[model samples]
Target: MRMYISPRAPKEVLDYAQAEANDSGRHANHAEGSCFPLSWNLPPGADLGEYEWVLNGFDTKDLPSINLVPVRRDEPWETIDAHLNRFGAEYLLGIMPTLWQLEVRFHAALRRSGIPVMMVPPINLASVPSLFAQFPIHTVLTPLRYLPELRTLLPSRDPHYMTILGPSDAPIECSPGGKVSQEVHLVPGMVALFQCETLAARPTTGFHPSDRFIWEWENDRLYVTDPAARFTRLMLPRHYTMREETCDCGRTLTLTEAV
Candidate 1:
């Protein structure tokens, strides 16, 4: 029988599995919190029993509306051309760690062939113009951590392609060039923030939250605070500043590790 193990699986089951795995030296490989980035947890010939551990979705219904699908390997260029032409895509958005090794090279080749390429970092947006000998992207959307690197890469002109900084669900501020803002807003309620803080699901077993953190940014430093709630052990960078701020969006709480 196939058993689905969500992050919300029974404590006993999770504990038992963890204990057994620890004793057996069979812990999941590349495991990130409740999820595994890859499926290489088991040995070459080991069986994982009938139980299927699903860290995210049970199936397609739980996935996002944005399609981040793989391209046909035999004719990837043709595939990209077809998709962009058919869908009328302005410029292709390339999320890194592509499905195939050749995907990145093909994308670079396409850029050389004069197609626009908007790469999400740590693919290095700084090298876009230098590598491709073309104009910089119209806009760059990156996590706050990468803003420092971006500052060194901004073109001389003011408002040289907008830069969006923040987490996925948070309300990102668009800077004209490379000026980092002091504070940013969340979408009021979103799963990305809850997941980041390792906030558990409500009684109904849903990950949605009515509360979220407002991030304060400065000098390439990030501090997040959500006073109404406390954080779990899984949050990154550990202890926080715990400052408070009043805003039209919502209450602001600060979190970050000691410098």
Candidate 2:
């Protein structure tokens, strides 16, 4: 699940899920969101070389229509050819900056890839109730580092933690541009991104409002606010990894950790 979730009440999501189950009365298991990112349902001992995680982008000018079946929109087809040609990409990762154009790009990307996408909405606009009348959420980013401070203030089950980055079943290196400069190995769990977007068109039972933080992506900061909704912004540097450190030329890898 992404760090930020829809602000709609959690119960509403449950009710929606209960009603959406198919003939089998089963809903698809939810994971993080991605547009054209590759997905994997690997079994133990399965060859990792069999799939690829495709990443792609599009312009806001031609956002397609994809409501119920966002994955069915027609793309130029050549868009993902590079990722496809590279091989084993069961996941499709898409980066979309426009909200009005999001649903369209998401649906088309989903349909074009025929796989699930990891959705990570920016929490840059996030704000938490202010503890001090004199200070603002904008001043809290660099100092707040653990979950206790968060739990005591926000009233949620998910607390904060140190971000540590490393490898998995295989030793994946997170940077190539110099380990310290490019590598950001965050600790386990999600990186809190406050200041999320407005009401999500679709709600899900997977997360609670208090459980996650919001982000103001454009500003690259986390937003916190007091009851008055005044703003306090914080930011944790985002972690990244290198291709060579992730998977071998013929291997598979999962881009996770403080994600």
Candidate 3:
């Protein structure tokens, strides 16, 4: 059968996957790398019915062990909440579909309720009461776009827990007292690596290449312009933005509320 690879797929993504696949003993949740960083497309001109593409580098032979907890689609909140409570997930990681939805659906209520409010991180996963009882979750990580929003939206006048950028193990420095200063700094090596090694690994997918990964920066502070940045297979650019700042508690990155 004929096969074609996506031209957008970065060489480093393939290299990273190959390295992980070859050395299966590495932890699956590495801070510096990701398991699935890009969306590789089948080459054009191949007979759709006659050709098939087999993705390499995902052979889970030596990857870390993880629980694939399945939840019922009909009543996911009930099902997942029970599981998390049973398993004791103190720190929960979640995905926000978009900043607009986050603001429209829950931000106001959340703010009114105050910081440290019991929540399931991604609001859809569980009811507020269930989250408080099942997990010790204090921090909710959103997409890179939401980073600026979170800095402004969440009642984080003080340095709370941790702020992880992209898939790296390094955490960004946040100010104390929750009043996030607009000042920022940038890291050259990480940014270059992300552009060449990570973001380079995927096609624009279904979106226009120009609109593929939305980003913005002012005074070296980063901002996520598009909300879709949360749900894409692209590399998270939070660190890329963080690496360009001077780390001053001065100016803030401009945030445009999604319409």
Candidate number achieving the greatest TM-score relative to the actual structure: 1
152-244, model 1: which lDDT tens digit per residue? 655452212212212322333333322222221121001222211111111111111213332333332332332222211112222223334
Relative to the true structure, candidate 3 reaches a TM of 0.22
Q: Write one digit per residue (lDDT tens) for candidate 3, span 51-160.
A: 22222111243144211211111211221232234334345434344221222223222333332333334445434334434655544434343455444543423222
lDDT of each: 0.31, 0.26, 0.29
Best by lDDT: 1
The residue-level lDDT of candidate 1 at 153 comes to: 59
Evaluated against the true structure, the overall lDDT of model 2 is 0.26
Worst lDDT run of 10 residues, candidate 3, spans 183-192
lDDT, candidate 3, equals: 0.29
The CA-based lDDT of model 1 is what? 0.31
- Best-to-worst lDDT order: 1, 3, 2
Error of 3 at 201 (Å): 30
- Whose lDDT is higher: candidate 2's or candidate 3's? 3
TM-score of 1: 0.29
Residue 5 in model 2: lDDT: 24
